[model samples]
Target chain A: MNQEEIIAVQQYENALSRVDQSVDKITVLMSSAQSLAQQGTQIMNCFAQLKREQQAYEAQFKELKLKLQSDLIKFQNIVKGAEARLDRHLDYIDKWTNLLLTRDLGTMDSQELQYQRNIMDAIQMANDNFNKELDKLYSL
Target chain B: MGKNKQVQKSSLTDEDLYTMLSDNLVELNEIELFFNGFLQEANVIDESFGTVTNIFNGLSMGVLASMNKSDNEKINRAKAKIALGTFVVGQVAKGVGSFYSYVKTLDRANDILVLKKEKAATWLDSLHRNYDRVLRSEISSRKILTHLASLGYQIDELISNREVYDVKKNLMQMALEQYRKARFNVFSMEFFIAECKAWLKNKHDSNMQQPILQDVNNSIIQEVLFQGDDYEEVIAEFFLGSNEISGSILFVLNDEQLLSHYLSTRKDPLIISDGVENKHINKRVLAIFKDNPALEMSNEFYEIRKEIDEDGEKSRKIFWRLIVTGSLLSTLVSFFNLYLFCRLVMAIDDNTAILSVLAIAALLAFGGLYAKFEEIYKELKNKISKNRENYERYYRYEFALKGGFANRRKKVEEVVGKSFFDRVGKAISSLFDVGDSDDHSFYYEKLIEREYWNPFFVTVSIMLILAIILTKLNLFFVGSLVVLLFAYLKMRMRKKYFYILTFIVVLCVVFLFLYMKGVI
Candidate 1:
């Protein structure tokens, strides 16, 4: 071909190539959009599963807290019952000692009453410790 | 000049070729400008691809499911394209529809641009909406042809109608896979937050009745699990109520406080607790503590502490064993010693083998009885009070020697330059003053007093007794006399030269005696 014809053919080819590349760019963008949407969906699902795991842990924590509170209450009640029985026995002893004063009667000593009081104190201390520990766990 | 120009023009085409060339060049320039704009757009998308892909993968399980869906779509599309290409190639080879196939290629190339125009616009709008700042700003200077003009002559040669059509088809097939891989980015914080929000929405939808509870749960879960720096809270919360919690907190909370708390407050003994949990905690604590030299020394400190504890327990047990059995056994052995000596004297006239057997049997019996008694005592002690601190004296002495835990910890911190063995050696050297000249002189003096004079006197007394006993029997033990003399010489001598001199004299005397008896 002549120089002018060659130049004209070259210009047309350049134009066509530019158009082809433009189409390729558009195609890339199209595919990119589809993938982005898919990725968004996938990421959302993974996050949901992780959230579910966290929820289960929270539920478990609540259940454990309730159980600890119940245990503390049960222990406190046991301590209170023992303390009441000791008080009732002390009352009975005080009432009967006066009736038997004329005869040689076996009597509960004041030391025995002190020992019983100490035992009650020890029980109360244990209950207090349990409550303190329960408080710390509840705060957690 | 006009006639010559007319002749030159007559040789060219009747078409306005120069004008047409100029117009086509202008079109080319515009197209180049548009192409560069698209490239810049692609570059921005490529950069965002990583961030988007990471956010998607991290936040969504749906990416994998979507990957499967897209992969199937790609496979089916590729198969259809391959079938169509095969049919076109077959028709062209048979010369049945060459023009038709050529037209079809051009149509297919055009379809990629025309068909996806609306889709591309929508996607571009979406890009702008989602990532406006991420998309690079357009270059204002209109330099159109520079980028594509530099793609080399072969690229220019290949940009013909047929080749362009072929290239477009290949580009489409390749672009899908690239896009799929570069689509999601779990690392993008914005996208990650959006994904978490989406998850919250989905979870709330499922439990619509308990939406408030779901929100609370999600918040608590996020706070507990995603503790960026304050990991101690996570561990503390994990072990709050359940003693039987699985896994370990060591990875999250590597603090010494956590380790010490775990160690001290363990419900079961270390021996009975789960081995895996213990191992994990142990490895993590050691690893963390190792970063500080002072803390690393605790490994040896704890070891020595444990040894000291075991020693105290052992000494106490032995003390009890001695009180219970050793005193009675010592008395029995003393009587037995006297009886055995008598038997030895008497058995000289009888079978010496029987004497040897009797001695071995007596020794074995004592050893066996002591061992059995110790075992019984240990079992009884264990049954009575397993956690008992019955031996005060032993513990007091041990603590006095080892110092308190605080003292040991201080010592570990202080002695950071030396190893455990080196520290122990230094301690022993200090006690003995082994490096001091005065200490050596004192040791030498003590050695001479105890080893030389004391043993010499004892040996002389034994020799006298033997001499008396052998004279009564009318039998002299020449070898025994020689051996006793040699022992006395060795004990008396302090210098090496004196020892050598005594050894020579002893050897000569022994040789002379042996020659006289014909026993050499």
Candidate 2:
């Protein structure tokens, strides 16, 4: 071969070497970008998870609030009913006590006395029942 | 040396022999390229302008070449002018041709856009659609439901009607929808009424020994004008907003005459003349006209009266309406221009030309829209300025009040917060308070729990339930109970059909809910 042929061959080899080095650098950069992209994707996924968790927490909080409201409503109804019943009983007791105390008892007999005792016992029993009912209500 | 001299002498022979072959080859290649370029340009020009430039160019050059000879004494100058005229005419033809071609390409691009529309829709809508889907995935809490309901409430007050924030846009849309239905029940009307009521109530309940009109200048004048309204003070504010007018009847008469002149010219009364009592006409007109003094002047007042009289033959409403109409027309023009722009961009196969044209068109369109809204923009801006001055006056008046009014306002807020428990307590104490929507619902719910059920009522209900259960075991008893219930219901509703309707409604609602829950 002549000198021109040898010089052309050398030039071609140098160009190939430069291209080979560039290819290696490009490969490294691509791999680094791929890793960064993977990390970015993971971060985005974590954010999505956090958003979902926040939604779940809000849902739970809402459910608890509703449950509490329902319970409160029910308890209030019971208390209201109990209060009405108590007021009725107390009003009757007040009238009965006033009547018994105010009544004239000069002509009392044994049968009447027995009847009075029975009435008193019955009244006491009613009072006890009312007290028991009120105690039971307060616990609830 | 003899051979060199002979070769030098014979060089022309060598060059001549070789030159003929190379020159022909190079010239043929160059000529082929040049002709191809010219042919392409001609084809584009012919396609775009439909032979306008191509045919017209030859005619124009011929005309110019003929016109140049012996036109004027400045023969050279005439020749130069002809050259310039020809160049300009040629360039214009080419430009028109290119634009036509560009517009055609833009139309083609529009067709492509139409084809790609669904795909673009998917990209733009997907995120918003996703957000909606996620938000709607669950059955919302009652509070959330209430919040959603309240979200559509009509805005009572806003500084600007059309100028909107992101949230305000949504609010205004809701408000406008409701206002369309409610009409007179608009937020502004409600706010005005409420403010008036509050002001009047404040006046009546005022702790101060002196009457409200005692301190203010011309208090009797205001009292005589705006009598018996709970919102007398609020009405007074409208009078006060005219920047402390001279209390003279002459000044008032002059002002009225000025306003009357404007109204006469406009051919419309500024005052609310309709439904006003006939007892006092002029006084009421004076009262209301003081609020809006714009009828006191016009753009015509700034210029020469003679010019204005000629121009003022037209209605003022028509003038503004014309501007609004012009804006609408400009919108149509912009839409057409957008269409043309698309066509233009499409015709340019080059990206650079397309981008440059797009930028230019967009800038023009935005600038044009700004110009269109200039009047309305100025009006709103002026309102803000006037409102600021009025607001300062209101603040000063409020601050100068009998000390406890602002404190009472704070107390009112506290009362609102504390009254709920008190109301519930009152419901328990008072039987009439039962079935009241707010207080009754609370007590009624509270009294019916299984654990603390009112023993007396509970026993009665339990006995009733047992009796019903025992009776229901027998078909005869069940039929009798149903008959009794039917009789009771009939006494009130007067029809057995009401029972069937109620049953059907309940069943339908239950079924609907179940179906919605996917419970079959």
Candidate 3:
């Protein structure tokens, strides 16, 4: 292989590693959100107990509990969406790595080059979806 | 042959493909970093929710304790009285809190106005700089292009070196667009500052309605939301647009590689091709090149300004409502005190009914006057103290601005030699510092010096002297009338006569002290 091809291969490997690291980070975020959801559930349970004992403030407790429950559901959905997008991105990266490894850069046809560009575009789209989920989580 | 050329152009080489991949990698890395930063901020917000929950829990416990019932009638009546007292005190506390918040908001509004003025000056300087760097260069380039075209040079050949001509044209266009956006920002900020000033002035006017505050608040919220919408536009136009046409060009014009590339491509002579249509230099581009450019206002400033206005508006409304409620409650309490006085006089002597009634009337008058005086003194003291601090802050800001202008002028003289650029710098500096030269600092200093001689202090002293004299002379009703008249004058008098009123108050206090000591 030529020096340019070698450099291209090195860059591709670097990109794969970066994508892998991003996937790991997303997993950590999902777990943290899961714990937060559990905490929210516990707080809701405590509110329910308080409502039973303090009938005078039953309306306030019910309102708070409902809000917490809705927030927890929203948080779970965001985590699920983020996880799915991260998986899709990993799949795209895998396809990209396979394409690079199997084909010689100088010998690739127009169809193969188009397919490579398509894979990169898919990865970018997945990144955008993940970012949207993060924005949802932030709002929640 | 044309089809073959088109096919060749459509297909990318290995090197081009690798370059594209590298760019994508950089973009992915940026996205990842953004995600991490967002996650960290979200975590902090999540932690704050725990504190909120704890506060809610404590409040619920307190509510439960207050809900418990008692069996004994006397105990129940006492409990009811305690609850009523707590309610009244809570309302008064809320009023005081609101007043404090309103004062703080006014202070913040004044600070924001000073900041906006400073920012306006900075923007003016940046506008001058941009005019010299971007607009002048664009104008000269357009003139050169037009001159060359008129001399029969083919624009296609001239623009073939995209690195030299096209980049410069694009930069100018982008800069002009940014400047246009900046002009809109400045206008909006100035409008907000004007609203804030109006709100401050309205507070001093007792006749100002609540609706005016609401209107100002609504406008502030609309401005804030508008700014948020503008941010999305900026991200799309500025950042995304930069990415589309050589990302580093707009941010780093003086980069070594770009400069070298431009310098190397500058040697091409103007050439003409017959019947070739010009694509690079459109009419719109040329028009923008001729237009003036302004400075870009940062989004952070808009965010901070919005927060200040919104917070101020909320506090002002609270202060107005609660203070009125507290005043009504105080009047009710005064009536209750009169009822108590009548009961005591009846219990003292039932046989001498008319004498007892007269004595009760006199006692009631004295008690009502004392209560009214105390309320007035408390309110006036609070307001005067806050106003004093605000005036001091005003003086400090004026002093700082004056000092800043002097330093700026000295720096211009020291750093810049007597060249054309230096002269332009001096002229612009002087233009912005025109307000400073008008002796605003001197005016503020004089105001601060006279601030200590407040009208409220004078009113308090005069009330004290009247109370002591009338009590000794058995003229309670006359004293009450005099006190009422003084209160009316105190409300009506302008702040400018503070020194004169203070002198009168001091004189009265000295005279009263001597009389009490039997020296007068």
Q: Which candidate is the best by lDDT?
A: 3
Question: Candidate 1 residues B1-520, lDDT tens each?
Answer: 3422342333222123222222221112222233333334323332233343444333233322334444345443443443344344333322322222222223322322332232223223322332321111001000111111111222222223333323322222121111111111111212323322323332101111111111221222233223243434544444333232211232112323223323322232121123323453443222322333223333443444344455546545554645445424432453355355546664433334434433433443444334444554566456333322222222222222221111110111121113446545544443332331323221112111111112334345534643453344211222233344445445556679667866666675566546545585
lDDT of each: 0.33, 0.35, 0.36
State the lDDT of candidate 2 residue by residue for B1-520, as single tens digits: 3422432342222223223212221112222233233334334433444333333454445434644453443443443454455456555655654444333333332322332232223222322332232222111111111222222211212212223222222222222221111111121122223322333333111122211211221221122212333323332343333332221221212232222322322222222231122322334334423333432332222222223233333323333444455444443444445445546654434444444443433333433433434444456345444443343333223222311111111112121122446534433333221222433231112212112112344345434643444333332332343454444445557466867855864675576546545587
Per-prediction DockQ scores? 0.01, 0.00, 0.01
TM-score of each: 0.17, 0.16, 0.20
RMSD of each: 42.7, 48.0, 33.0
Best by TM-score: 3
Please give, for residues B1-520, the per-residue lDDT of candidate 3 as tens digits: 3423343344332233223322221112232233233334333333333333443343334333443643444433444444454344434433333333233323333333343333233233333332232232223223322221222222343234433333333322322222222222233223333333433443211122212111222222123212234422332243222212222222112222222222212221000000011333243222221221110111222243334444444444444443444334333443344445445643433333334333434444444455555565566456555554554444333333321111111111122224457545544443232212333343224344323323344545554655554444333443463466456446667765645765665676576546545587
Q: Judge candidate 2 against the unseen true structure and give its global Cα lDDT, from 0 to 1.
A: 0.35
| Tens digit per residue, CA lDDT, model 1, A15-56 | 997787556545544554465566566545644643554465
- Model 3 residue pairs with clashes: B154-B271, B154-B272
Q: Write down the TM-score for model 3.
A: 0.20
